[model samples]
Target: MRILTVVGARPQFVKAAAISRAVTAHDQSKGDLEDVIVHTGQHYDESMSRSFFDGLGIPEPRHNLGIGSTTHGRQTGLMMNALEDIIDLESPDVVVVHGDTNSTLAGALVATKRNLPLVHVEAGLRSFDRTMPEEVNRVLTDHVSDLLCCPSSTAVDNLEAEGIVDGVHLVGDVMYDVLLDDLATLDSMASPVDSLAVDPPYVVATIHRASTTDDPKRFDDIVHALTQVATTIAPVVWPVHPRTSDLVGGLTVPDSLHLIDPVSYHEMLLLVRGARTVVTDSGGLQKEAYWLETPCVTVRDTTEWTETIDAGWNSLTGTDPDRIFEAVDNSSAPETHPPLYGDGHSAGRIVELVRSLPH
Candidate 1:
């Protein structure tokens, strides 16, 4: 089985890593399994892009589209134009896309256009807000995917309501699979937190969403709230995203708000695990925080991973400064961290499902 996997963003790299490992194992044991990766270059920076491949052991993409920062429509259009040819040349049996980024939808469109089966991992997720770009991508991808592997029951419920019942499977979260595998070796890896000069019981903040950074008011409010947390609760260790690098320059950042360059996936796992609380606008971070059992304060009003909130592990505080600061101070998770996604074997299950699909 030849599977063409399309990945663009940082989170997608981690998910792809899990699937890649599964494919390697399947190839060794069962034979005739190939996982071909295509990098869309949505995350353009070398630090953000190459480090993930090295850190996670994902096979380098056969094609890197280099579809860097642009308007959403143009970026996706460029990816589709480039990916269509790759699809034609490679002639893959199944095209698999990871998350709800423009890359995901672009890959989905090209696969269906070529009349190939499309398998969407992390499918059927919804924040129910049509205004969010991710929400739209998830809906469109789920409708077109031949196999919709959902991470949670809520995601499956979302798909059922949207009238997508066929080819839907309750596969566990691929992120969890990667995390579980990493946990065994994480202690041996050198800690990034120590290099930051930050002590224990610190808050980790990752605010890169357009909703927070593009809006000046929200960005300023988030900064002020993070400063508050640093002053009162704990120091905020923020790894600035490459997209947000320019915007971070003009701001009057305090010393307490330690703004540093992005770290590798392994470094990130260590950072989150040691954090007193995690504050982010990123969808992936919410689940990572929940998995790490670290209290999470989402800067957005709604989250696709509502199960985390329902379990008393996460809180929604939008861009309100008071709420953001308070949520950090009062951040506390429940006693038991029940495995919401699945055990460390989701990648194996996904491989089995893909094998069963009629080519």
Candidate 2:
């Protein structure tokens, strides 16, 4: 069976690494699986693009659309057209997409129109809010998918609640697989400590979403909260997102904060692994910090990954400075390590389900 895989964002790339490895391993054993990787170029920056595949040892994509950045409608429309063309040429048995990126939504639409089976990894995740574009994408993709591979029981329940009963399988999280594999590989490499210019016990702050960092008040609140933390030696190291950096340019950042360029996935993984604590609005980073046994402070109002909170490893502080400071101040060092996501074998299960499907 031949499969067409779509990846466009940093998180998508990370998820794809596990699937690609699974496909490769299956091909070696069964001698029938073939995977064609397509890069949608949603995250076109070099540091975000090439470094992930390099660090994770994922194979190079068969096609790079080079779509770059654009308005949401335009980007998805372009990807839909591009993916339709590729589907026509490759004619794979199944088209696989990961998570809720625009690329995943576009690939699902194209596959649905073509009458090809769609497999959505990380399906059935819901924050129950329509305001987020990712939530919209997840709902649409799940509705159209032939197979909904859910990472957790909560996701399966969410899909059933939304009346999606067909093809929902609890196939663990592919992100867990990727994280375990990469951590084992990269832990021996030199730490990213010196590059980030922070001491060993510093908190790593990452803000990417427009809602948290673009809004002036919210951004200032986060900055103020980080400044209020009474750490004498360890500074808060923030690898600023390009969008957040552009919006907050010329604004006064606290002297105790060290703002650096975004690092590669491997470097970020190292930072997460070694950090005293992690503060972020990123969903992926929240799970990553949990997997790495690092305490986390989530800055968003809501998170789809509630398992992290249930495990008592992460806290939701929103963007309020007082709440943020309170959460941080009240948070003690994390000692509990729970398998909130899965047992780090989601990739193999996903591949097995794909191969077993009627084509």
Candidate 3:
């Protein structure tokens, strides 16, 4: 069986590595699986894009559509066209997509229209807010997917509530798999701080999502909070996301805040591992910080990964200066917690499930 895998953003690229390794390893043993990777190029920055594959050891994509940024509808439409064209040519038995990016929604639509079976990794995640584009994408993609591979039992219950009874499997999180595999290599690499000129005992900050940084007022508020908090002993090491940097052009940064370009996944892992604390709006980073045993302050009102919150490792500060400062001041070292996302064998379990499926 051949699977067409689509990845468009940095997080998706990271998760895809697990699935890719699963397919490759399974094929090596069972000799019946083939995989093709397609890059939507939604995040086309050199460090953000190419470095992910290199850091994670994922194979190069078979096709790079090179569809950069645009309005939501336009970007999804362009991706649909490109993916449909590729599907027509490759005619794979299954099309696997990860997460709820525009790319995932586009790929699901294309595959469903073509009557190809669809598999959604990290499926059934719901913020229960229809206003969020990602929530809409998740709901739509889950509705269409032939196989829903979920990370947590909460996600499976979510699918059940939505009446998706069949083809729902709790196979844990692929990110956990990637996290386990990359941690060793990341530990071997030199710290990004030495190269980027950022000092240790720093708080790592990352802001990218539209809801957090798109609005000028909200962006300004976050920046102001960072400035206020910079007076503390430790500095802030912020590897700015390309999108957020563009939105906050020419904004003055506090001297204590070291703003650098986005680092590679391994570099990011190292930074997170060594950080005194992490403050971010990234969902992935929240979980990653938990895994790295770092205290995390999320600059958002809500998070899908409430496991981190329940474990006392993460706090939602919601872009409020007082909350941000308080959270930072009160942050504590993360105690080692059991994997809420699951044990680090999700990829292997998924591979076994795929192999057991009737052809």
What are the Cα lDDT values of the candidates?
0.90, 0.85, 0.86
Span of ten consecutive residues with least summed lDDT in model 1: 247-256
The stretch of ten residues in a row with the least summed lDDT in candidate 2 is 227-236
Each model's TM-score?
Answer: 0.98, 0.94, 0.95
Clashing pairs in 2: none
| Model 2 lDDT per residue over 87-159, tens place | 9889899999999889999999999999888999999998877888889999999999999999999999999
RMSD (CA, Å), candidate 2 to true, equals 1.9
Return whichever of 2 and 3 wins on lDDT.
Answer: 3
lDDT of 1 by residue, 1-359 (tens): 79999998989999999999999988997898899999999877886788889888877789998989899999999999999989888889999999899999999999988889999999989898999989888889888999999998998999999899999889899999999888977989877779878888999999888878899999989988998888888888988898788988877767778988888888888899999899999999998988888999999999999999889999999999999998998888678787898777888899999999898
Alpha-carbon shift of residue 216 in model 2 (angstroms): 2.9
lDDT by residue (tens digit), candidate 3, 176-249:
89899777787678987887577767888899988877787777788877776676747888888998877656
* Residue 345 alpha-carbon offset, candidate 2, angstroms: 1.0
Measured with C-alpha atoms, the lDDT of residue 238 in candidate 3 is 82
Highest lDDT scorer:
1
Ranking by TM-score: 1, 3, 2
